[model samples]
Structures are given as structure tokens and as C-alpha cells.
Target: MTDSTSISLPADQRRREFIGGAKATFPLIVGAIPFGIIFGTLAEPSGLSAVGALAMSIIVFAGSSQFIVLGLLAAGAALPVIIATTFVVNLRHILYAANLVPKVRHLPQRWRILMAFGLTDETFAAVSSRYLQQEDIREAHWFYLGSFCAMYGNWVLCTAIGVALGEIFPDMTQWGLDFAMSVTFIGMVMPYLKNKPMWAAVIVAGAMAIATAALPHKLGLIIAALSGVAVGLSLQMLLTQTNTHSPAPDKEPQ
Candidate 1:
């Protein structure tokens, strides 16, 4: 099957959806600016050339993995080790793609490929609510593209600026601006904790993360993610059963 939002609408609706997506993603973009800049600032010191850094941001487009790679490189880790660590860190994208598959299951191959390339944590966070919460979206993929493109463009520009300023500043990454990423994530998640499954997932994930904080090679992250998924799934199953068994309301007289 192809991968798109499936439903088609008028050009006006598509434009509105696209604009809405861009506007919704703008705040997260603002938060990500510093994180992107810090990555760029640290890249050269981490043994990457300017072109290499820019290319990684453009090609890899994974902020977390890029930073992990840089850190591993700086620490003199073997190439295989660096690659494996980045792979492990990025496994969550699999879950992201699984969740999004239904929305884009009918699109053409090219659009699906573009959407996969553009899938980032920030864009996923912004786009999921729009797709899952709304019952009808005339052209949802356009909205997804809008958010993805805005974040992607912002990240590239920030990286470029950071790289250029890295030589002059030399300590930009050490400036404690990376905390904005945490704040941005918190903002994204807070609005969605509307039910037990969501809350369970977050709580279990947070607890697991804390408990496994000392694990080597960031194995703790994997544990936390898995535990959260299990908990969320279990809770969802229970909720589904409960709903299934509940008594039906009496029908009113016709």
C-alpha cells in the first residue's frame, strides 16, 4: 500500500492544513534552535569538518543521533561502536513510523519516502495529535509536511549559523542551552496526558529511565522505552476489554 493521509480535499483546505501544521510546530522549532546551534558548535571540536557537520545535519537529520555520534567520535570510540550506539538511540523511530503508518498507508511511494525522511521527534509530536485526535482531515499529509519542513529548515539554518560561529565562540555548547530540549518535550507531552494509558506510559518510562540511568551505552533508554511500551499496551488492552463488557445504553423510543 502507498503512504499518505489518503483523503483528498480542495486546494484551499490543503493550504490551510499546511499553514496550521507550520504554525503548530513553530514553538518547538524555537526551542530546538539552541539545541541545533549547540550541535553545530560542538561538531568541529568533536573532529568534524564544517562540510561534514552540515552534511550530517542534512542527511542524517537526527539531532540526538548526530550528537551521540559526535560524542563517540570525540571519545575515540571505534567506528562500529559509534554506528551501533547511534542505531540503538534511534530505534524509537520505528515506533514512530508504526504509529504513523495508518495515516499514510495510501500515499505514493515518493511521498512515503519523504515522510519517513522527515520524521523527527518534534514533528511526530506535533503531527500525531492532529491525525489521531481529529476524526477527519481532508489532506493530513500536507499538514505533516508543513510541520516537518518548518522544523527541518530551522534546524539546517541553525546548524549553519552555529558552525560559522563555532570558531569565534568555542564554548557555545557549554552554555547550558540544551535544557530547552527537555522543556520543549515537556510542553509537547503535558497536553496529551488525558487518560490512563498515556499517563501510564509516561510514568513508567520516566521511572525506568531514572532506575536505569547508570546503564552503559545508554541501554537505560532502551529499557525505559520498552517498559513504557509494555505498560501502555497493557493498560490499553484493559481499557478495551472494559469498554467491550460495559452495558449498552437503553435506546430511546423511536
Candidate 2:
């Protein structure tokens, strides 16, 4: 499946799709730069070496968890504690990655895994929408690569910027850039809120997150995400069954 997914796109089409997708999603990465910088700058204060700080961005390639890791390191948390927290902080990514796997299943395993790692909210939002709409796995792969490249580039570059000049900004909180993450999420989710099922999922997830806020180790986010996914899936399944079982209103009685 992996090889087949990538084989559909001709070489030239693949290149074109890659470039186009990259251009389309480039601005999103630009918007996310400040958040990356803020994370990097805070890394020094977290007591991690510059190498380790930068390495996390390159290898872990996740923004929120990297920041959390830095803080945990600064607090002198135990190694297991740090790993566990980072894993929890990143659990939402499983949702991102699982959704994308089918679209790129034709690619080879190595490519599939690499692409999976590159998956993030912004890139997945951009690439998956196009992939699902077109049903062109290779083009979707190209789009994913483009979106991922743009995001990956910005993250690496911005981390360097944050580390080198973060002190100049003084306070990331003061600049109001933190709102960008919230705004990014809104931009991604709002467009898909035209239906009741989706709206229900959003409401359920948010309510759960708020309700679980007091749970230890910031477990609320996990609960919220799980609740959101489960509610959405369960509701969808019930609706499917209801539709399948019920007679059509247009047909009426024979």
C-alpha cells in the first residue's frame, strides 16, 4: 500500500504538487515562528544545554512538548517523570498521525514513517484536507512533504533565533504571541464547524478539558482529546446506524 500510494503521482506532477503545497502552507509556519523562538529561549533557563535544546526541536520536532520538557528539566524532574510528561504532552499527535496513515499507505515504510513523524497540526490540517478531497495519495504525499518542510524549516530556524536573541524580547508573554497558537487552532477547526456532529465534538472536548483541569500531571488535555475523539466517533457510528436502519422519508409507505 505504501509503495502504491507514492507510485500514482508522476515525477513531474509530484514535484509540482510538492512545490505548490509548500507555498500554500508556508505562511502558517511563519506565524508559528514566535512560538518556536519562545520555546528555544526558555530552554536555556530550563538548565538544558543549547545542544540538547536544539536537538529536541530537530528530533522531537514538536513545539508544545519541547517547551514542557524544558520546564521539567529546569525543575530537576526525574528522567522517567520527564519522559512520561513529554509523552503525555505529545499524545495528541497520535490522533494527527493515525488520520494521515491511510492516505500515504502506498509509500514505502521508511517514507511512511518519516512522513508520519513530520505530521503536525498545521501540516496535517493543510495536507490531509487536500489529500482527502482529491484522493490522490502521491499528491497528498507531496503536499505533506511541502507542509512538513515549511514547518520543519521554520521550527529549526526559529529555534536558533530564539536561542541567540531570546533575551532581547525579554518576555514572550508580554508580546501576546502566545495567542497565535490559539488562533492557529481556531483557524484550523472553525472551517470544519459547519455541521452538528463536528460542533458537538468540539463542545464535548472543550467541556471535558475544562472539567478535568485539576487532574495531576496536566492529564486534562489527554482526557479532553480522548473524550473528543470518542464522542465524535461514537456519535458518527450511531448516526450511521440510524441512517442505515431508518426508511427514507421520500419513499413513505408502499
Candidate 3:
């Protein structure tokens, strides 16, 4: 059931491909709502204008970057500093785009760039997981759009509420809601503990995170994520090689 995503599609497939991509992305969009709500509620007191907050959700949709920008603004940082910090926090998108080039290469330049803007950890998870199933081009674009659109809408609406309620809302710290990010990470990681190699990756990454937790400006997160990616990829490659070289298991005698 592999398709052109695995390289080769029928001429008659038409725009059906787009539909698949859109459909696959929808659930992600739905799931993004709570995160967006938290961001809005937390950032409300940071002096984000409705238009400005809306624009942020529209343009710099990355959650981490948005949070950094809000944090900077909360600290009374300069505009240039906030913008630059946001850009730095989102630089990981460059790597995401590099790895994803092959998947969206066939799309128009405008669409490809727009699609790249939609890249996020959750979107990456969905796309990569789909590729594992069959690499069907049908799913990527549609699913991505569906998810992106939902998340985008959620952010905009939440930000609007936060901005509208700016003066009256209680302090965010009062809610102890800042741990949403930590909870989100745990949610993403716990499900991946399926086997030995995955466990190895998690352990290595967790150790690295603790070791580097003292680093400044959220650098520990980057270090830990990269360590996990590298170790996990290496282990997977090694296991693949070993399996390929080993003889097949023998059947029991009747």
C-alpha cells in the first residue's frame, strides 16, 4: 500500500494527495488547543496587544519561541532582543526543514515555504510516524494543513482572550500553570519507552539534561533533545545492522 511518498504515484491520483495530508493533520490541530490556551492565559499580563499577540500566533507560531518572546517582554527587554531571542529559539526549524526537504520537494515553492513555517515538534511527530507506516504522499500535506490550521486558530483565539482580559486576569504564577511545558514533555516521552534501545536513548538524554541543567537560557533543552536524537539514531542503526547480519531463528523440531 506504499505510494509516491515511497516514490511513484499514478497520474490519476490528482489532488487526492492533498486530502490525505490535510486529514492526517487534523487531530494535531485539535490537540494543540490546550497548549495555546495556556500560552494565552500566561502571557496576558505581559502587555501583548491583541493585534501584536495575534500577529505572533500567525507569524512566529512556534510555541517555544512564542514563550521566549513573552518571557523577554515580561522582563522589560528591548524589542530587538525579544525578536532575536525568538529567532534563536526557533532555529531548530532549519534542521527540521533540511530533514523534510525530500517529503515536500514536489510541492510549489510558495507552498513548501508556508508548509515549513508550520513545522513544530508535534507536526514532526505526526509526519515521521506516518512515514513509518507507508510513506504515502497523500497524508502529509493534508494532515499538516489540518493540524497547522487548528493550532493556529487556537493560538489566535486564546491570545485574543488573554489580550482582551489583560488588566483583570490574575497572576499566572498563582495558577502554578507554568509546568505545562514539563507535563507536555513527559507526555511525549513516556509513550516511547517501548523497548531497550528507546530506553537507552531516554536514559542518556535524561542524564545529559540533569548534567546540563545549570546552563543558561534554555540551552539544556536543546542539548538534551539533540543527545536523545543522536543516541537514538545510532542505536537504531546499529540494531538494524545487527539484525541484517544475524541468521534467522531456527524452528522447533516436530
| Candidate 2 lDDT by residue in tens digits, 1-254 | 37865776588687888887788677677668778888877877778767877898899898888877887788899999988887887889888878866766678888888787887888878886787577546556777787888899899888888887766765664676777777777888887787667888899999999999888677899999989888888888888999999986795577
lDDT of 1 at 141: 91
TM-score of each: 0.90, 0.88, 0.76
Colliding pairs, model 3: 4-7, 20-139, 21-139, 21-142, 21-143, 22-142, 22-143, 25-143, 25-147
Q: In model 2, which runs have C-alpha deviations exceeding 4 angstroms?
A: 1-9, 250-254
Best by lDDT: 1
Candidates' C-alpha lDDT: 0.90, 0.80, 0.68
What tens digits encode model 1's per-residue C-alpha lDDT throughout 137-187? 548899999998899999999999999999999977778999999999899
Q: How does residue 217 of candidate 1 score in lDDT?
A: 74
TM-score of 2: 0.88
Stretch of 10 with least lDDT, candidate 2: 131-140
lDDT of 3 at 224: 79
Point out the worst 10-residue segment of candidate 1 by lDDT: 2-11
Clashes of each: 6, 7, 9
